[model samples]
Target: MAKKQTKDQALANNRRASFNYLIGETYEAGIQLTGTEIKSVRLGQITIGDAYVTIRNGQAYLNNANISPYKQGNQFNSDPLRRRKLLLHKREIAALDEAVMQGGKTIVPLRVYLVKGFAKILIAIGTGKKNYDKRQTIKERDMQRELGKNLKNYH
Candidate 1:
């Protein structure tokens, strides 16, 4: 028997989004990819550093995401930077629309990955953290790290 191969090949992740926002809930959404776009993504040549999600007309879409064109795609290459539509359920889109309508809440793309040979995007409903809130999170993380170190020393 042959080993089954997995289509992981994570294109990109927005690590800073976690620190800057209080993520309330996460949802997985499918992205509409062109032929060249999928090829470029599979090659792990994409970036989501400045990507964000927005709910408009009961649909969620990605903005400011960049997927590098395939090297040999030639005339068939896709736009390196373009707005891509994200597929989500109707109820999910309504919920996202409501959350984003709140004062400081936003929809942000956390990471882009492939699953079962299909591309998937993880979206988070987040609230922008104030400066003090960010500092508190940092302090808590530091404390947790210190506690782990102390526990290891005791053992």
Candidate 2:
């Protein structure tokens, strides 16, 4: 059997998303990309840090995601920052739209990875975290690190 890959081996991850937003439900969506875009992604030249998802006309689109042009793609390369369409079911789109409209939630890209040789994106609904919430997160993380260090020393 082949070894299974984990989500941490993603091509690109928005590390700040967790600190800045209280992430809710997450969904895996397929991305429509061109040949050169996929080449760039395979090279690990993508950034989802500032990418966001928006639903329009019942379709979800990824915006502001930067996939650097392939070095050897020449004229075949498309715009690096072009908006890419997300492939999601009609029911998923409807639910996401409703959540955004009624729950005041935002959709953000969490990570991008290749699954079964296809490019996929992980997106999540999130509520923006306040300044104090961010501080608390930092404090908790620090405490966890300290506790781990002490435990390691005792062991």
Candidate 3:
């Protein structure tokens, strides 16, 4: 018999975010999406690789996140690259705003997933990584992969 799978699952992940930045604190923010957009998300038609979070007018906005147009949406589908609003508390927005103001720090989306039928994004404070830092990340990742392979062979 097949077991029922959990409805909560990741729709998109920013794999490059970790390689490109030094991540700090993280927060979960709700995303405001249209009906078609939500439909596309549930189908895993989303990309958040180059997406980032920004604060303006005391509100947080998600930029560069692409939610592809639904196949049957036709004219009902909105722009795939349109800026989406992120729902967060005033204090949370203020904290993110303050972190950005500290200079050299920015907010980036780590991943997007569904929670109770609603889309939620995991955002974090990040500082840009230097070229050398990126190289170190690559080295560490390779080492981890090699170690995992060795352990499997040992077993």
Kindly list the per-residue Cα lDDT of model 3 for residues 1-155, writing each as its tens digit: 63322434678989899989999999999999999999998888999998998899999999999999999999999999999999999999999999999999999899888877788899999999999999999999999999999999999
**Residue range 5-122, candidate 2, lDDT tens digits:** 4666898989999999999999999999999999888778999998999999999999999999999999999998899999999999998998899765899899999887789999
**TM-score, one value per model:** 0.86, 0.93, 0.92
Candidate 1's residue-wise lDDT over 1-155, tens digit each?
Answer: 63332544456889889899988899999999899898888777888988898777777889998999898899998678888899889989988898887768889888888887678899999888999998998999999999999999999
Rank all candidate structures by their lDDT, best first, as comma-separated numbers: 2, 3, 1
Candidate 3's C-alpha runs over 4 A off are 1-8
Candidate 2 structure lDDT: 0.92
Query: Order of all candidates by TM-score, from best down to worst?
Result: 2, 3, 1
**Judged by TM-score relative to the true structure, which candidate is superior, 2 or 3?**
2
**What is the lDDT of every predicted structure here?**
0.86, 0.92, 0.92
Models, CA RMSD each: 2.6, 2.2, 2.3
Better of 1 and 3 by lDDT: 3
Q: Worst ten-residue run, lDDT, model 3? A: 1-10
Best by TM-score: 2
Candidate 2 lands at a TM-score of 0.93
